[model samples]
Target: MSRKRSRLSSEEEMSSKLSDGGCGEGQNGSETSITSATSQAPIDALQSLRQAAPYSTEPEAIAERERCHYGRIPRAAALAGTAHRKVRVYSDGIYDMFHQGHARQLQQAKTVFPNVYLIVGVCSDSLTHSRKGRTVMTEDERYEAVRHCRYVDEVVRDAPWEYDEEFLEKHKIDFVAHDDIPYTTEDCEDTYALIKAKDMFVATQRTEGVSTSDIVARIVRDYDIYVRRNLARGYSAKELNVGFLNEKKFRLQNKMDDLKEKGKKVMTNIGEKRVDILTKWEEKSRELIDAFLLLFGPDGRLSNIWNESKGRLMQALSQPPSPRGSPPPGENGDSHSPVHSRSSVSPPPPKSRRYETLYEAQAGNWMHRALNVLATRKRPHSGS
Candidate 1:
């Protein structure tokens, strides 16, 4: 009877401990089973999310789920649920020039599972160039870009072009996430056939209207414009890989574009007032013409004054000279006093020539007197 009583006490103690959430080696199996049972609702919710259409717009489902659940939506419930370890997701890409598209793909992969360890794989430059053409960024740069993403947890460099069982097992990847579109290569129809066959592929929606190829195409389309813009921003022609002629051409084009833009702005500012501006310009031009005419035109004040002076000069030239002092009382042609004869038909000699002739005559008279004195002194000296 004591043994039975001790056995009952032991059993009761175990049951009490289990009920109080006690953990022990013996109770671990039972605890796991109970946890699984309790996690069914969240698991079901996650399964529903997965099965739902990618672009479903039905708000009733969300409303119903919100009404039923009280806590945050469980992440990675399909594989590990919220109570288990996080699901490991692997996504591979060239991821060159890390744009919004790459970011969105990683984001979708991250949130597709509530708790996720996102591992991004970047391909090597040689592999990419051999199979997928050249990439804008080098392998190391691409790896660093993916590593710094907020959604990425790990970065794998020189990732394989195609996934195999060994690679997946090595990474312990739970799901290989990418776009739904099949990636075809020369050797095979789809590179991800193995992953898809193993049911490890998770499809992420591709963001429309943007892609790396599209971005590259745009750059190619506006090649000159971008080069010119970089040059304007202090980049050199050699850095832009432009030749001398092309650089000059691009600069000229840029100048022309700038001129066009300036002209457009000027016209926009002028708007509907161009006619008024022309009219004002015409008024200013007319005022200038009037001022010019007033100053120096054929009928201007200066022209009139010149015409009057010319008439006075012609009248003075046409008139006869007045006689001076009535020719000094009957001296006519032989007058010693310098005077004009009223009776003479010809005009009198000028004062300058008259004074010159008078000086010459005085010099001649002095010379004759000297000659006469010399002749008298040396009159043959007859007595001697």
Candidate 2:
């Protein structure tokens, strides 16, 4: 009976160890085992679910078949009233310049459902140029731009210009998101018509007053202005693709603008100082006029002195000069002629015709006689 009780107790102890997470270690070790097993339970279940459905008739199997066949998501599971899953949303565009409008569109696609797996497709450069026009950014740049967007969960390069069933199924796209506007192409009136007909088109609200085309239009409208601005900011003309003549023309215009600004500043300064300048000019002009009158006015001190000097000069000229042969004045020797001796200093030069005092009639005769007298005069003999 003791052996039977011992065996029963051992069995109970073994059952207890199994209950403690199938490990015969301590409580902490048992707890760790429990945690690891709990963590792996979901992964194991997922793996089983994935592996069990090839031949079964379960609902999961049917859904898997549908997904494999048509690449369609269970739309009912992600509806408003039901539990939401990760809805794979697809959007495509040239995405040139990658502005806020593009970001807002991606954001709409991201948040349209409770959880969205946003797959953004950037069209290739060749495709974009062929279908629409040349893009400002390259294909690689556009792809990276879309890839780095916060709303995008994945980025597909070289995306199709138009969507087909093969394209949609390849990307596993549940809904195609874009604006509601009818996008016309050369081959079709509406590019999204098929997606719309298939009930896979999701509309996004476009931001008003902003778009890539609108931005490009603004740049084109102010082309010259932007060019000038960049040039002033030290961008070279060659880099800007400006011809030599255009560069010179733009520089000349900039110089003219600078001159205009300087002239305006100068005029403003002049205007501010005009009253002071006029006041100073009035005071200085009075002093200048007074000095001018003192020097050359008709009744000035200079005129009175000039008249006195003229009288003395005329009196001296009226009398004959002392004979050249006569002894000089202040000499002890007596003069030969009975004419009064004159000052020995040379006479003043004759005035111009405009200021002729009294010799206007005798001027030519007097000049001739004076020339004859000067020619006849001989140098005094010097003793050896």
Candidate 3:
């Protein structure tokens, strides 16, 4: 009896084996038993098996599934919902010198839309070369850097040409956003037309002073002290005149008027020396007018004769004063007067030449003398 019982237990174990050839009962009974065994597995193990399988409702998967169901909606239909959904798209170039202005522009763009999707399209180094001649950063570096920006949501390689409308439509874009830069309208219009045709919106935000070119210029200017020093050393009189005086002509004229008013107000308080200096300046100004008239006067012979005499006088005046300190003898009977004391001063003697010619020569001589006197005197007030 004990042997028979042990044999029965062995048979039962064999029947429950994973790969038994057949059931002792029949094929139909074996199928039913196998099904029953699988059903009897632990609930935890079954749960784990289900979990190991891929998720059917993931975001990407759901999008794909929805895409399939919608069968790629028409570009028009995609844009139909744009009016209600405020979506903004921003794009730009190198952004190498990223500053507060750029940040502000992005911030303003974000404020304008409910859903801001910054689609940064960095030009490839090769494409940038074709358009801009060169770029400061490599394509990969630009891509990585733009990716790290807080405002940027996605990055793409911008082609040599403009953004493709079809691609933008496929993405269901709404408003196209950019900084308000010169020529941006012309550039964006070609791309904007497509967006507008699809009934999508467009916007532009004003950026302050930040620009890649401006940044580069600032860098060059800041570090170019050597160049500036060399320029100062080699500076020319004409260049200085143009740069300092001529450039500020309008402002200087206005300042001169203001100074004249101030001088009038303070005239009584000024000293005798200051009065003398101001009188000399006024006399020099009159001499300038006389010189201009001499050059462009109606009498050609008179003007030519005056210029020759003035040149000779200037040469004589430029020479060192004689040690004896005596005036040259006059043609008239009256002897040359003393040069020192203001009370003993005497004007040039009358000439025997034609009265009109002598008068003209004397006037020209007096004007030249007055100019020299003014030049020698210390200026009371600086003129503009």
Best by TM-score: 1
Candidate 3 local distance difference test against the native: 0.53
Q: Model 3: runs farther than 4 Å from truth? A: 1-90, 180-191, 196-201, 224-384
TM-score: model 2 vs. ground truth: 0.55
Residue 66 shift from truth in candidate 2, angstroms = 17
Candidate with the greatest lDDT versus the true structure: 1
Which lDDT values do the candidates have, in the order given? 0.73, 0.73, 0.53
In model 3, the clashing pairs are none
Model 3 vs truth, CA RMSD: 31.2
Per-residue alpha-carbon lDDT of candidate 3 for residues 27-87, written as tens digits (9 for 90 to 100): 6876766644543323322333344211223354235234432232333543453432324
* Worst-scoring 10-residue span by lDDT in model 1: 52-61
Number of backbone-clashing residue pairs for each candidate, in the order shown: 2, 0, 0
Task: State the displacement of the C-alpha of residue 146, model 1, in Å, after optimal TM-score superposition.
Answer: 1.9
What lDDT score goes with residue 142 in model 3? 65
lDDT of 3 at 269: 58
Candidate 1 residue spans exceeding 4 A from truth: 1-83, 260-299, 308-384
- Give model 3's TM-score versus the native structure: 0.35
Clashing pairs in 1: 75-114, 76-114
Encode model 2's per-residue lDDT on 152-203: one tens digit a residue. Answer: 7567778887888787866667888999999998899999999999888889
